[model samples]
Target: MRGRLLALLIAIELPIGCVTVLTAATAYRTIMGDIEASQVQTTDDFAVRMRVWYRGALRSLLSFGATVSEAALPPELCGQAGLKMLDRARGFSAVLVRSADGRLCSAALDPGIDAQVLERTAASMRASPPVAPWKGVDLGAARYGQASIGDRRYLAVHAQNPAATGQDMQEALLLVAPAVLESVLDLGRGSKGMDIALVAPDGGIVANRGDTPPEAWLPRESRPPAELDRWHAADREGTERTYAARTIAEPGFYVIATFNDPHERDALIQLAVFLLAPLATLSLLCLVYLRAIDRHCVRWLRSIETAARSRSSSKRARAAMADDMPSDIRSVAEAFNAMVDEQEVRQRRLQTALDDNRFLVRELHHRVKNSLQVVQSYIGLSKRDYQDEARTALADAECRVHVLSAAYRFTLADGEMQPVRVDLFLEDVVSMIANLIRRRDQWISSRIETAATLSVDRIIPLGFLVADVASRVLRSTPGARITLSVVDLDEATIEVALEADREVAHQEPPRLFAGLLAQIEAVQSGPAEGRSLGRWRVRHHG
Candidate 1:
């Protein structure tokens, strides 16, 4: 039973475990995926802002390039108009020009001499075909190959001006500044605990208003991804950082941004509170449910067991006869109680039957004894005035009657109307026969053998038949020795034999007296007949 209970518990627990694991896994994956997708979306937004701002800056450079190429004035006047105009343009790093042959002609920067910077810008333009001539050009002798004034960075559009006779070098120069990109990056920051920046693909600082230079904000090789991608990495402080990066065409730079672990701490706390609050409530509910089950199920089972044990040891009827008990235990109690009831009823009935039978048997034995004695008196009375042979026959009939009475007496002694032992009945019969013949001056010795049991119905007739044969044999020769006995013939038959006494003189057996003969015939269906040892013998079968 304990094993069965344990199996039931395991069956319930396994499905609960499976459901918990599957639900947790699905929720965690879905929440993390949403977080990752939000990060990517934020980066794309930042990149789009930067793209718009940088495109404006590039248009500024292109306008300056067109004005410089269209200039038709003398070199000195062109220089004054162009220099004044470039200076008023905010965040221009330098306004310088190169001849179409790629030489510095007139310049606001390095007006006296230029060699290395122009050559480098020319070489860069030659190497990059897809980029505009303004791309990657060094405008002045800035150490980063560009100037970051305020938040804008600049490089020249062309290494050389158009070689028109008097074009100003100032108008030919294009400026790249970090300030425009920085403004865009700052707009994205918006006081959020996140970093935003635009980085050069060549690892140059393009624009950043972040707390640190964009390159130093993350690992050395880390920059905005060329397409939309997001990832998780550790910051220098060893805290988890999730980031998204994308490349923008207008800035010609990578826009990279990150969400700091601190930035997500509140969201995590809120999520934990959300998840844990309900989980705690559910756990309490589960415990309460289990307690209820124990109260209702386990306690009920224990109560049933207690009731069963009480019933086992108590003699009284199990309380209420268990009519409405749980089906499992009800059957056993009912069957046991039914057997007890049946046994008690049967015992009472048997006791009453036995007492009544005893009374009847005793009464029967008394009445039958009186009747046989009366019969013996009648035979004695009848013997007077009768012929000697008739008187002797009457005595024989009386003795046979006594033999039947004795057999019934045995039945009464057994105290039942049931069968009597055949062997014991024959023993009594033999003794009676021997005694009767002795009184008649017959030398009779009897031996009886039998295996058939005689019931009350047959005991009287069987004994009367044996007695009649013995009398006839004794009378066949007065003063003769006779042997009388019974033996089993089969399941349904008994055979009795009587031999005349050899000590008696031989004589024809006296004809059976009419009345005695008729009584013998009624029981045995024939008269006793035959002779042995020159003396008569009689045989009767019952």
Candidate 2:
């Protein structure tokens, strides 16, 4: 009897054990998935914002490009051009313009720059683009700006403004600065608690976020995806993160966006485990109890029946049956039946919930898509009446709205963003901008160096800013070459330069542009500045 009872107990407990283990596993998986999804969404948001700021800076610079290009440079105007470049040196650590054949045009050196060394730097600057700072022709040992303007030997990263294709191949605009500063500024460094950086493929930091000491930043080494077997990484302060990388539209560059947050998949896993564990435990206990009842009560009842059959039938037989049959068996059976009934009810509720949740998810997707379309419509309408400067502003606003829509659409399509690939995101942005620019302007020729791609986070502002600058320059300088180049100036930095005509004059004195450049410098937590000529040199039209 005892053995039968024990068997019943064991059976009751088996279900509980199974439920516990299964619930735990399910819960863990769900949570992990949620974390990944959340990370992706967060990273996407960051990328969008970063792109916005970058655009602002680029626009300010483009304004300068346009104004400069329009002016017809005379021998006298070259000095003013040099001075104007020197004044606009707020975000840039250094500004130097060189001719196509490598002659120094105009330059503003940051304090401690050796005039002699700068001359040497200028010579090397005239050389073809260096494949890498270390591998390229040395401009002689010179102090890099970050370590000390005069203390550390550093290589200069160069940028150029070329005459529009087929116009003047021999004329070019040159710019050079410390690669580290440019990288830091582009990462949106001034925002407190936000750590942005560029990491080399070999696990070196190209630049630390502005404001944070290099030592305080974590080493690029010892970061994530133990189980991922070679996945790109994005993490927050040692916690798990979701990140995406895209090669910069610029050749030979990469950009990444990262975020740390919980994903929906994690919630699903938690819900599963929460409900499953208790049910399994109850099932296990019930099985054990049933086993005990079977051994002690059912077995005894069977024995009594056998003995009664062997004896003469009478009241004694009935009495023997009553005495031998364990009442516990009836009690246990009743309870088991009650439990099965309860489980059936619970199952029905679960099914209803699942159905409702499915409906809700579908509805959510629909609403998000509608919302994005509406936003795009609004921006388009607003852009219709604006012109000149106002048009530029409107265009930027529209671009941002489009970006927001893209974010939502991306999420809806994937159910969540994950391991966000920055290059892909940037490629989309570039295509969109290029199409918009091409479609919008028939008179002015605009070229997008779609070849350079940056992380989506970086792209948000950088792309827009680049476009804005180009547009402004095209508008201001009617017949000037505008070349936009993005290249690694060093292992840890990237730089952009705009060179336009020295004689180009703005309808307005560009006081506002100057101020804007200052603002960009302040916010970027990096060096930046601007200058404008009061007049342009002419052919002495008699």
Candidate 3:
């Protein structure tokens, strides 16, 4: 019993368990997806701020370079102009003017100038056209490059004056203050295990901060493309991280930030709780339901079944057991006992009514049979000594009486009250009419075509109509064959058609049958000429 109970509980819990697991899985995916999106958004916002800071510095330097070129000052006075420009620029560490022929014309360095950087800057300017500082441009006009000045690293921006049409091809090189790039990288440094880097066009690390080296954290090939803006990857430690990258307006340089995601571990814990909590709750509910059913329902049902089988003759035994049962079950037991008592009373009353109905039916059949015979006898007496036409009319009256007698006999043929078959009833009427007027010299043939059945009340009147019309047809044209047809037009209506071999003159129905014709919804007659065949059609109302 314990095994069976456990199996039942497992059967009920299995589907719910599956659903709980699926729900937990789906919830985990959703939570992780949201966390990923939030991380990407945070990184993207940081990238935007970095791009703004870099572009502003590039624009300021480009404007200052154009101003110096337009001044067209000689190499001797250019150094004084550079010092004045540095004083006005907030984040410029140094400003230098180099000529097209590899000569450093002017210099302004806060931490003092480096001779090697000046040579390299002059060399790079001669080799490549100036790369544009704005985004979406190929690296051709305005350029950004990294320079090692003494032991310290510096980022350089080189701009040329293509609009300067005279004298020498003069260009300006500005050394950006390291603090500017450091400030942008500092944004993500507050978070634990977070790293930030500025990458150059040739995959060189321009500036970076945090425990991991920028190159080891993100290889050049693994960097997110410019269009994607952000991506996810795992580092050397195999811990998954999200990375966001944005192209700096100055040529091929990009800003990228990486951080470890804390949501993944938290989501795992939430998913475990989500999967197990419902199962534990459901298991408890199942145990409670089993205990309740065994105590309140199963034992009471067994007792009821056992008492029923015992067949106790006393009502007290059944009542005492029923009173001891639960209120809900006790009410059911009372209703059952009450229904049995009422059914017994109904059976006795039904038997008495059956006996009465049998006697009434027999009496009705006897009286109807005797009355029809009396009327038939009266017609026989009245027809005596009459002429042929008068006798024929009396014979028709006797035939109608005989039809009513046959209808009563058929009604009684079936045990009690029953619907009469219209087709069979009409067939009998047609056969009787055919036999009544039938003679050796002049044979009167009849045919019935129908698949309809009606009750005795409806069939009797219908029979009268058919017999009256058939009788007239026989008298009007001797040796004529007649057809009686019934068709069900629909569920609630029927059509009856009578046709004869010869032309049937149109005559209004007798006063007795006028009411019956009114009961019919429609009547149509076709003459026996050309396409209008001789036929009488009657449509019964629904």
Candidate 4:
């Protein structure tokens, strides 16, 4: 029972655990996939917005470039044009116009630089935005560049301007501060924890939100990715991140977006908790249910089982426990106790009735023996008045009475419930008969080869018959040997044999003993006169 209950609890709890784990695992895949896709969309939107911002900024910068390069502009005219450019476009922090010979001819917004920044900016702009190389007095098509001037990052647009001096051309440089890129990123960042970067083909970060350069985010992605590619890679901190790349301004620039990986595991854990709490509560409730059954039912059953195992017939029975039990259990205990007590009471009454029966049976046997003895006494007294044969007849009658008396004594007083054992009755009856005729040198031997018993009524008559036959045999042939036996032939039958050896002429059995023969169902197969005699045997039910 204990094992079954434990198995039942396991049967309930195991499925709950398996389902929780499977559900969490499946949900982790599905939800994380959605989260990754959402993050990719974030980067995509930011790339689109950055592309739009660049187009407007480049157009306005180009218009200002046209203004300055309509003719050769002096320092004052360049300054006024640059100030107006700043007022028109908040994205522009400063501007520089330099001649094709690499001399700084003009500056705006209190710019604190030599001309070397513009020269290097022009030299690196060849691949991106497809700008041509500078020739003597003729700079190629316009292009944008991201450069560092004195540790500060700037985005610059450079274009050729028409100059009156044939070998002299003009180059325009526009500087954008880091603060402007940050504001653009703010517009694209959503609830998703996203990081974005504008990357150049030279493995340089054009603009990014974090301190780590964008190319280091995926060291293997230093080469340009195809348009709108997505992959998983590790960042500079040796942690994995999901990255998506979109070509924004192609000739080798792209927008790279990374899904924040540090938070992924934590997010999955939170989702698992959201699914696990209710199931955990259900598991706890199952435990509580098992506890309640033990408290209310199983404990009571255990007590009843203990009592039942210890019950004995010879000793008083133990009652089932009932104290402080639930009403249902108490009722069962009460019924069990009542049943045990009733059986005990019935057993005691039965024992008392048996005792009473023993007393009555013993008294009856005693009185019966006394009556037979009195009859023997009267026959012995009557022998005084009889002659030889008559006196011998009287003695035979006296011996038969003595046999009847012995029969009564051999039987049990209190054991009247069962039949008399045939062997015991034969032994005692044959002994008494031999003793009664001992002076005649006659003795009877008796035996029963198998076990059998008979009712008192059937057994007492056989004793009388055996005693009378032995007396007659001794009278007819002095010193006769008589033998008696009862043998079991089968479960339902027995054979009683009485035999006497005779050296004299054989005599017939007397008619006077016919009544005894009929009473015991004993048969006489011999003639009334002289007959050969070796044995007298009877077969009957055991």
Candidate 5:
């Protein structure tokens, strides 16, 4: 609450720094568009090489098949011709011809031919025959045949031709070695942060750029992004990363160009540029603005706060703030001064009220004394002209009047606004009643048992009730001692009972009944232990 001016300055300047930092970070990704463009161009070059490699294998095999069949070579002579073909095959691993029933007959290679791998590749090409390319290295009548077996990497190129017997067509598979695949990938790439992989259609990685495995760019559990764009996947180490994957050389085999995430490096670069940007200027501007606020605005507000908190009754702190200030802040100071002036005016009015109350008290005391004398005169006249019942009624009336007068005088004397003590009020009522006993033999005594206070609104009614009941007992049975039991019923209520012996005053109060005084909630007619004639329950009021 006290730092509102400082907070306002913070609210203004903080957003500028935040928006600048965020926009700069977003601009970093916009810069990544260039790196992504580099990767796309690299993959285009790699895909062209993949096409040459796939189609070149077929052209060489077709040449071998025609050379063997044109010489009327039998199944046994096919090995001699394939051996001659292998010498000029470049990176070819093995060239094998299989009989249509699928067992191998002739083979030529550096090591023994993998007849089973060739048979499997032939079967795979039969099941999922590939569509041929529309352009670039379309070898005539060459069907796609590639496979990844165990740790061996190769592309199987198959061609079918007659054995010169013309009974059935024989299948020949030419396997391109790993080195040949590497040369195809090594052809060209004009990009950074990119690695190339020749993945078989069955998702086996055959040849790649380095040992960092294609698994490092993309995890096994994740599918690549649908477009040539960024995706989130974890590496082999289970650390999260971001990369881009684009498929080249499609359909027959996937030339998936995988890129390592270079975002951390990019971010470092961006941070350096951001530090050199207008960010320092923004910070300096904020500092300057905050200092200006503290100098011009906050200084005046704090001085106004000091003036408001001053303890002097004379209100001399109004000049603490200088007159020269901003128009808005000056209005606040003026409001503070106006509130102080109002408070001072209220103080003088309260003092005047206190003086009036003192004069009122003096006049009240004189009137109460005269009223008691008039009550005494009425009692004298009732004794001479009336019977015993009427005289007793006048005496009860006189005691009730006295109780009210004493409560009023006690409440008004030197009082501001405070609750009247029940014990003190009852003591005064009881003392007045004791003085009322005229006969030498008749006497009144009391024991007040509780100490509580109530507002004057409740105290006056309570005093009237106590005096009314006590007067009944004293008048009905002369010389009967009175015990005023003032006990707490609960936290919110108090009970008063006049316990006496040999009194015919068990009837309910006629003048001041329970409902007549809203403060006294109820009346008890019967004595619990055969002593009290009447008991009144008074609820405490604020």
Candidate 6:
């Protein structure tokens, strides 16, 4: 039983472990996926804001340049007009109008323009003819560029207008301050350890703001992904980060943001702990339960087995089962003890019955022997007297006694006080009587047609009746043949008939014969044709 229980535990525990593992794995994947999606959404939001602001700045620069280029005013008046425009334009640091031949036509600056910055701008235009190869901007029309002068980066926008016929076109240059780009990239306000930057088409950092240095804002070897707006990758220092970028409209620059994902590993650890803690606790509980069973239940069962093997008295065995048994198994022990007690009671009853049967058998043997001996002595005494009538009566008495003795012996053979087969008993009695008469010329035949049984006391009188009737027929009709039959008339009665070959002397039955019939509650009905045939009907009083 313990082995079966252990197998059951294994079956249950294995499936529970499998289900726990599957649920934990699914939960971990689902939670991590949510975290990654949330991070990407945050990065995309920052990119969207930056894109909107950068496009607005470019549109402002274009409008300012277009206004200055189409003006038909005097050079000094144009310079004055450009200065007024600069005051209205928050992004532009300076506005300049130049001739097609690299000559400065008009200029406006908040802080007075430097000579070196002007010379450098002129030289760069001369070196690259129709469109300058600017450091930041990638437009072939030379419409936009990023220039550095005296450690200050400027976003330059140029626009040209042709004269009426065949003349040099008037050109306008709008120099945007670095602070305008700084404001566009400064949208990383919500999340910590995030860097937002505007990356030029040529892969240079135009402006950047974040927790890290400008060089570290974007990895050196990394290129913007073309397909996805947001992704994760390792930086030049092998630190993992999530990145998102959006293209700025007019200038075709990228607004990229990188965020350090602190929750990824921490969330994974939390998920593992959340999933495994219960399983570990369950395993511990199982172990504790097994130990408890071994301490209480298993030990109790072992004690029961020992008591069973001891084969002591029932009371001792019941005591052993009850002692030191756990409360949970107490009912089982009680039932077992009850069964043992009932068995013990049955065993005692059976032993007492056997003793009574043995005693009865001994007494029955003594009585039967004494009775047979007394009959034998009477026959001996009658033999010594030699009177024919007395001898005949004594011989008949002896024959009746012998028949009674045979009935007792036959019934007692089975070692029980039970009824004797009446038919079989009568058959044996008739045979014995015929042999005792010993007449060569006479033949006696008996038929027992009854299927009934009677007790020893009941059969005794019936035996006497059978023997007396047989003797009278033999005397009255010498050299005659007789047939005797016993038949069951009903459930409660039997009939005995005797038939002779010749008619006997018609005489009333003797007093002793009448008394024997009365003792058995029998009635004589026949003796038709001068007693040649007779029948006696007996009702079973028992």
- TM-score per model over all chains: 0.47, 0.35, 0.47, 0.53, 0.48, 0.50
lDDT tens readout by residue for model 2, 1-542: 65665667677666766777677767777676666554444334443443343333333334333444444344247446755665665444433433433343344445565335555555554454322222234322221111224554332343344543321112222333445244534544224333444333333344444455534434344442221112344233444433444322122223344432233445655666676667766767666666766666666566555544644544223213234446774554445446555765787899999888877875785686688678768867877887667765666556656665554454445553322232344345545554444333322222223232333233334444444554455456555543333333344344444334344443442355444333323122222223222111111101
Error of 1 at 108 (Å): 4.7
Q: Model 5 over residues 155-211: C-alpha lDDT tens digits?
A: 677665433244233666787777777876773434355666766555667677854
Q: Which of 1 and 5 is the better model by TM-score? A: 5
- Provide C-alpha RMSD values for all models, in order: 12.6, 58.8, 15.0, 9.6, 10.6, 12.7
User: Which window of 10 residues has the lowest lDDT sum in candidate 4?
Assistant: 131-140
**Which has the better TM-score: candidate 2, or candidate 4?**
4
Candidate 3 per-residue lDDT, tens place, 120-170, comes to 765674565444445544322556767666777677777665544454445
Clashes of each: 21, 62, 6, 0, 0, 0
In model 3, state the lDDT of residue 436: 64
Q: Comparing candidate 4 with candidate 6, which one achieves the higher TM-score?
A: 4
TM-score of model 1 (CA atoms): 0.47
Candidate 4, residues 1-542, lDDT tens digits: the string is 65687789778778877787787778777877777776667767877887667665656665665566555577677667777778677767676665555434444453655445555666665445553332233234566557777767777666655442432446566777767876887733243556677776566777777545565565453556676778887677677777887776545667887765545777678667956885788778778878988888888888877777767543565655646789888888888888878887997999999888887977787888899989989998998898778877887788778767766766654545356677877887777666555445766787778667666676777777677666667777767776676666568666666666554455565675676666766565443333233333444555
Model 5 — TM-score against the truth? 0.48
User: Of models 3 and 5, which has the larger lDDT?
Assistant: 3
Error of 6 at 205 (Å): 1.8
lDDT of 2: 0.44
C-alpha-based local distance difference test score of model 4: 0.67
lDDT of each: 0.56, 0.44, 0.66, 0.67, 0.64, 0.67
How many Å off is the CA of 17 in candidate 2? 11
Candidate 6 lDDT, 15-116, residue by residue in tens: 887888788788889888887677666656655665455445445544554454455455677667767777777776776655444444455474556434
